[model samples]
Target: MVDILRADARVGNKTYTSATVVIIGAGISGMCMAIDLIKRNNCHNFVILEKSSGVGGTWHDNKYPGCCCDVASILYSYSFEQYPKWSREYPGQEELLKYLIHVAEKYGLYKYIRFNSEAKEARWDEEEKKWRISVEVSGDKDSQFASSYILNSDFLASAVGQLNVPREPDIPGLKDFQGRMMHSARWDWTYNFENKRIAIIGNGATSAQIVPEVAKVASHLTVYQRTPNWVMPRLDTAVSPLQQALLTYVPPLRMRKRSLAMDFRESFYAAVSDAKSDFAQQIREWCVEGLRTQLANKPELWEKLTPNYSPGCKRLIISDDIYPALARENVDLETRRISRITETGIQIEGGTSQEYDLIVLATGFKTVEFMYPIQIYGSNGRPLSDIWKEGASAYHGVTVEDLPNFGMFYGPNTNLGHNSIILMIEAQSRYLNAILGEVLRARAKGKTLSVRPNPDALKRYNRELQEVLAKSSFADSNCSSWYKTEEGKITNNWSGTVVDYQRNLSQVRWSDYVVEGSAKGVVEPRKITHLGRVREESYMSNGSLILTAASVLAVVGGVLLRGSSLLRSR
Candidate 1:
């Protein structure tokens, strides 16, 4: 793994910088992969290409008002480094970003990350058994011209998970009639909303969070909704100082809290995966009851806000303030189809129009397009765009068939509907680490190795995956979602529970893959000192078993009475 090669490449006069592995994106997935490589494999010959200036991927990109995670902080964070200092049940964007930065600094991952560097293209070189990656580096004040460089690596992995690219709706005359138009992801924080007549499009999770905050200042706000979603209460609460102290001192108590939160979140999988199950019925009832009680006086708004389709068809919106915000006298919920965008405002289908000073697009993202805009040339120089023309598909949402020795973090059919995505990312990191570790072991003996998923295995896995998903609420024809393609193929989200995905990817089955090449001379593998593992263990101080037992009883009693500050309701 330590074999570093540099050569004058054909593309410009620049030389190639080679590493054992080249990972794309420095988000949660990338950071976790780097940490596992050091902890589990004891490998440091890797480079992370981050397009942004910072490390916290989505959290860094999106800074809209009231932006917060719906999942509980305990389950949302990494398993190895559980955070006991979260200020709230559901963490806000700022807190989450700080946590990510803290983890990156603790692991010393900043040295491996190259900021302002975007991976443009990657081509597999069959003869050399390496991937030649082309990266575009944005010019800084010191540099006069932007430059490109070449990086060669034995293994290539994409940590560019879903939800990076913001989606701009194809509305007619949008560009012509735009009045201070901005997407929610790229919010203009400097712009003032006081006394401004605002129009926000889309009513998804992002919109739910933005409405309440924007409504407080806007003179009038119009929410254009094509379809209503099942909105549930967040029931968020702050963590008291006493609770934080208990969690900080009693490490075992924190462990139990996280375990309980994970199990509770995992149990909701049945409600999402099986739409007709008892769990689904119970959730639907709770949402309906909550909606009616919240909007009791304004009974007419209940019918307009309730969804006709089954629950879990699209992403669920969890908020306790959206209803009250929409009920404000200055706000209007427009259900009519948008005919077009005029110079001043949106034109309804009935030829009526309302002027607005600003338009905020809460449109979600290009989720189905995984690793898009990145030209990937796989085996025999086949372009990834042409290969996935129908829709993106991967074996267990990790390795592709033609893309040898390439693994993706959050690929197709890997997004969760009811559980934390951090779980899926951790599973993929471990799987890739296992595979890459073996490849390095073979390289020590002067052997070149290449591995790709078996064609039959890829076919069978996707077939079974889609078969199970077809019965889920996501496949309902009445609803359209980012989880599916334009052709109605369910390309995103797993078919089963989080536990199922973890168990399936627990170990790599060499039989399900086509492994090539053999080792030549008998050379001993490099002995790696497990210093990083020891350091990680030392970082988390554990108390004695007797003390931990006593603390658990005391902390558990207080948590039960105070309603478990770490847990939040849906």
Candidate 2:
């Protein structure tokens, strides 16, 4: 392993200066990319610029009262490093955040991360074959160091993730609200909800989690439901001391347990993809039963909350105890549409006033707006905003046609409907590492290398994605979701299983790229040499002959040894 300090010293040199790869966000994706680049590819000329002071990205930011992962804790973690010691099946936000921090520390990713350093804009410089990035430090408010920081790197990986910015609804009199108001992503811990009248804005995953938690302590909790989601039972359980001890001692047992969890999660994708399947019907029935049992008295409320669209149209909310929380006397689920916000309360469409001391908007995130609040200009001096004006897209959700040597982790159409995102992240990082390997080989041979996806190929890939998405529950128009953009395009989700994505990116197509170098200098093709083939051939021809010769020599040697032993005894 190369010393990170030595690696930093080696950077900015004549040969290694051009090899630096800049990663925008220090989220799960960014950290995963860094791990792959350094440990696997041995490319230490990289820097991760994170706006936040710490890691965990979304997990770090959103720390609401009852914030937790909907996905099973085992499946949510990295496949390579399975954590068999989860406190619950569905781990809380703090636990998940700690896990991410552990992963970062274990990989020594902190040295590569520059906290509070935000990339304001990145422009591709065609003449220099590098990206001119303009970054700003948060504390430097004087604007004295406004000069662009030139990063002469061969590649740019935007792992900034899709869900950085929070999306607030356009209410008529939102600014007029006199009481304290804040988004769930930006939770205000200073404001005490104890004995205070609280009003939650949206009834999505975040709201579902927050309402149940704050309702226990709040004077009054009113949940404003825009559109009710299909909520399912979360069979969460605490990890027993016995199980924890077994995991610590028996490694194979933990591996088996993780595989079992993975298999169970992957089975859900079939139901998500095909709404007409038996598995899908079973899930729907369970959801219906849950609603019927919970809201037995208030059938009207149950009917209003029940979704008309398919199960996976929007994200499925997991809560075995959310309905019980709402059933409590202190909790109230308001299905009425908000007409406007008053000076000290909210006004319903039916001329009703619901006053609250505090209002929390669990309104989710602005997912469609990729890399928002930052300008990205590609080749030909065209802004990324203008390029993807219609909708954000990338070749294989990693590379774009015109954007040479630029890669995106968890980019458009890469979000999985099933399985762990860590699995996807590992696969993407490996693919990017392969591309970087090719770039380094080209550089070593004193050649210039540029790689981009073919426009036609990209078109076909995206067309197939759109087609699958249309058939899936995400395209269901009855419910409005963050998965769909303004124009009703599903740009944020993968329409298939995680295994399919892994297979697709298993190998990088070198022919899809363009290479430039000295006219006289011959360049080696970037391809994986099949050492397995040579090994197989050698085994087939020489194996039997070599074994026979060895057997005869062994017999002769044994006879000689026996004769020598008999002579010594006599």
Best-fitting candidate, measured by lDDT?
1
**In terms of TM-score, which candidate is strongest?**
1
Residue-wise lDDT of candidate 2 within 214-288, one digit each (tens)? Answer: 989999999888787888898888888898777655554565566566667778887766778788788889998
TM-score of every prediction relative to native: 0.89, 0.87
Cα-based lDDT at residue 507, candidate 1: 64
> What is the lDDT for 457 in model 2?
76
**Error in Å for residue 276 of model 2:** 1.4
- Looking at model 2, residue 327 earns an lDDT score of 83
**Which regions of candidate 2 fall more than 4 Å away from where they truly are?**
1-19, 140-150, 514-570
Clashes of each: 0, 0
lDDT of each: 0.83, 0.77
User: What is the per-residue lDDT of model 1 for residues 1-570, given as tens digits with 9 covering 90 to 100?
Assistant: 423331111112232377778899999999999898888777777889998899999998999989999998867889888888899989999999999999999999998888889999999998888899998887484124447878988899999999999999888988877578899999888898889999999999999999999999999999999899988788888988888887787776777677667777778878776778898888889988988887776788888888876678888888989988987888899999998888899999989999999899899999988887789999999999877888999999999978888999999999988888988898889888887876677665667878798889999999999999899988888889999998989999899877788878876777677776564121123222121111111222335544757777887898796786556552
TM-score of 2: 0.87
Name the weakest run of 10 consecutive residues (lDDT summed) in model 2.
529-538
